[model samples]
Target chain A: MPTQANSSEPPELGLSGRKIIYDEDGKPCRSCNTLLDFKFVTGKLTGAEGTKPLSAQAPAECLEKLGTGTVTSAAIGESSSKAYPKEDPPDVNQLGRASWTLLHSVAAKYPNSPSDTQKQEMKQFMTIFSHVYPCGWCAKDFEKFIKHNSPKVDSKEDLGRWICTAHNEVNEKLGKEKFDCDLWKKRWVDGWD
Target chain B: MPTQANSSEPPELGLSGRKIIYDEDGKPCRSCNTLLDFKFVTGKLTGAEGTKPLSAQAPAECLEKLGTGTVTSAAIGESSSKAYPKEDPPDVNQLGRASWTLLHSVAAKYPNSPSDTQKQEMKQFMTIFSHVYPCGWCAKDFEKFIKHNSPKVDSKEDLGRWICTAHNEVNEKLGKEKFDCDLWKKRWVDGWD
Candidate 1:
C-alpha cells in the first residue's frame, strides 16, 4: 500500500526509533539560519514503541535541527561467530574485534575518519550508548550527542528552544571549518598520531 | 546552564528530546509549508562520543528521512511498581496480579494507548523487532520502523526523506486521537467500554 507522502521509505533492515540533536547555542535547528516552529509524521513498523518498522516525516526546519544520518550497523552478521552481549561490558575480546570489524565496515563504506576529538567523542559515546542503544561503537558518537545535549525539560516549547540554540552553534562550526575524516580514521584504527 | 531558548510559554512538563506532531494532510512541517525546511540536531552525552557536545543545523530540505523524538521519562512520581506494559496481551504479567500492576503502571504513565489496529500490529512488530532491538516492547516498535522504512537510502539526503514520510505516520496514530489522562486512568483502574 502507498503510505502517506510524509511516511518513511520503508527499511530493508526493519528498524525504527527517534533521537534529539542540539546545536552549540543549544537550539534545535541552529545549524540552519532559522528554527522550526512545530512538525510531525507517521508510518508502519516491525517493532514496538521505541523500536519498530515505520515511515514518517516532520517539518524541514525541525529535521535540520536534528542532524539525522545513518551509520553502519555494529551487529556482527550471523556468519560471524561472535555474540553481542545485551548487557554492559559485552565480552571484551568480542567487542574489540567487533570494533575492528566495524572500523573496516566504516572505512569501506562512509570511510570518513572523524577528528581526534570526534574519534574520542565517538568512543565515549559508544561505551555509554551500548547500554542504551544497539549498534555498539559504530553509532557511539551520535548517541553521546543525544545524552549530553538533550534537556530534561518537560515542556515541548522549552525543549524546542534549547534544541535551536545548540543546533546553531554546531552548524556554525561545521559551516566554518573543514574536518579530516581519513586522518582521524588512521589514528582510531592503527593508533597513529 | 542556560542550554537553549524558550520561544513560547513553559510547558508543565518542559518537553525535551525529539518530538513529532502532524498536520491535517498528515505531513510534517516542510511538506505543509514549503517556505520552511526541516532541521537537524546532534549532541554528545556526558559519558559518550566526541569530546564535549556537538550539534548542527541541517538544511530545511530533507537530507535523511528518519524519525526521532524527545525521551519522556514522565514517571509522574508514581511508584515503579505501578508501571505497565504498553502492549495489550501484556508481557511481564506472569504473576497475574503483578502483571495487572504493570498494566496499571502503563495505563497511568503511557502517553497514549494503542488503537484496535495498532494493538494487533504491535504484536507482529514485537517478534521481528526482538531480533534487532533489545528487550522491551518499546525497543521492538522502534526497530520495526527503522527496518520497514530506512532501506536503500545510502546518503543523509535520502534518509531524511524516508524518516519524514514514514515515522511521522506511525507516531501520529500510536496514541489515541484525543489524549485524556483522566479518562485513561479510569479505564485502567476499571475496565473501559
Candidate 2:
C-alpha cells in the first residue's frame, strides 16, 4: 500500500506492558532512545524504562539524558548482542552525526571576512538552533557551550574551528575519536591537498 | 607533523593560473565549488569558473548557481570518468544531503503536539535556517519555499510532511528520486513494524 501523505496516528509504543522509554507524560523520548531499543519495541522485546542494552557482559548506563540516573550496570546474562535496525528513524547518535554535518558545512562556507550583520545573523542562528534541536539535554549542553565559546563568526575559518572544538567536546562525552581540529578546512572547505 | 590547532593560511587555490573557480573578488567560493574541483585544485586540473565535470560521455550543465549560465555540454572527447575523492571537504551536494538528514530528523522527534511557544520557536528556527545555510542560491530558493509553504509547526506529523514535500522539490530539481512522502514517519520517526 502506498503510504499516505499524512497521518495523525501517534507513534506505536510497541510496548506489550513493557515501559521501555518515556518522559514524565509517558511520551516516548525519541532523542533518548537508541534505534536498538526502538527495534526491540518492534520485536516486542522491550525492557522497562531505564533499560539499556549491554553491548558486552558489563553493566551499561541507560539512555538517561531525558530520564533519571544512568546505572553503571546491566542485568547479568542478558546476552546483549542485538544489531540496531538501520531502516528505522534516527536514534540519538544518527541525529547528532547528521546535524554536525550540516552545522559544520554552514561554518565551512561562511565568508572569510563577514560583515557585522552576517556575524550577528550567525550568532542568532546558533541561539535559536539550541532551542529547536530535538534533544533537550543536548541543547542545554549547547547553551552552555555557546555561553563560553559563542559563535566565532568573524571569519569562515574561525567559525569552522570553533564548531569543530565544540564537536570535539561532544565526542569526549560519547567516547568517540577526536577529529583533528587543525584540519577543519580540509574537512569542510578545501580538500586535503 | 601534527595538524595545527589553528592556521590563518588562505586555502591553496591549487591553480596554476587556470582560473578554475572564483567569484568576482578573486576569492574561492566554498559553497560554489564541488569536492571534485577542490580535488582538482589539489591535483591542479582546474578549468575556468562555471566548469562542471561530466559523469558520462555527454554534454552537461555546468554548476552555475553562483556563476553565469550553464552551458549544455562538456568539451568534446573529455573522459568523464573521475570519481569524487571521499576525504575532501564537502561540496554542495554533500552539504545538501547532510542538511536534509538533520532537518528531517528534527521534525521526526518534534513533539506530536506542541505549545504555542514551541511552535514559534520552530518557525523561527526555519526562518533563520534559510538565511544561514551556506549555499546562497540554495538558501534563496528555500526562502521562496518557506514563503510559499510556510512552516507547519502545529504538529510533528505536519512538520514532517511539510519538510518532506520541501525536500521533494529539491530532489526534483536535482533529478533525484522523490521520496514517498507517505512513508515519512517510517523514514524519520519509526522503524517499519
Give me the candidate number with maximum DockQ: 2
Over A83-143, each residue of candidate 2 has an lDDT whose tens digit, in order, gives 2233545566557767888898889768889999889888888887887776677888898
Best candidate, lDDT-wise?
A: 2
Clash number for each model: 153, 3
Looking at model 2, residue B51 earns an lDDT score of 45
In Å, residue A141's CA in model 2 sits off its true spot by 1.6
Among all windows of 10 consecutive residues in model 2 chain A, the one with the lowest summed lDDT is A64-73
Q: How well is each residue in B74-179 modelled by candidate 2, as lDDT tens digits?
A: 2322113432233545556557766887888789768888999889988888987898887777898899999999999999999999999999998787655567
Candidate 2 CAPRI grade:
acceptable
Instruction: Estimate, for each residue in A91-112, the C-alpha lDDT of model 1 and write its tens digit.
Output: 1122222333322222221113
* Per-chain TM-score of candidate 1, chain B: 0.21
Which parts of model 2 have CA positions greater than 4 angstroms off? Answer: A1-28, A40-86, B1-34, B37-86
Per-residue accuracy of model 1 over B53-161 as CA lDDT, tens digit each: 2232432112112111121112222223433222111111111222222223222221233344433333333233223121134335556665675432333233223
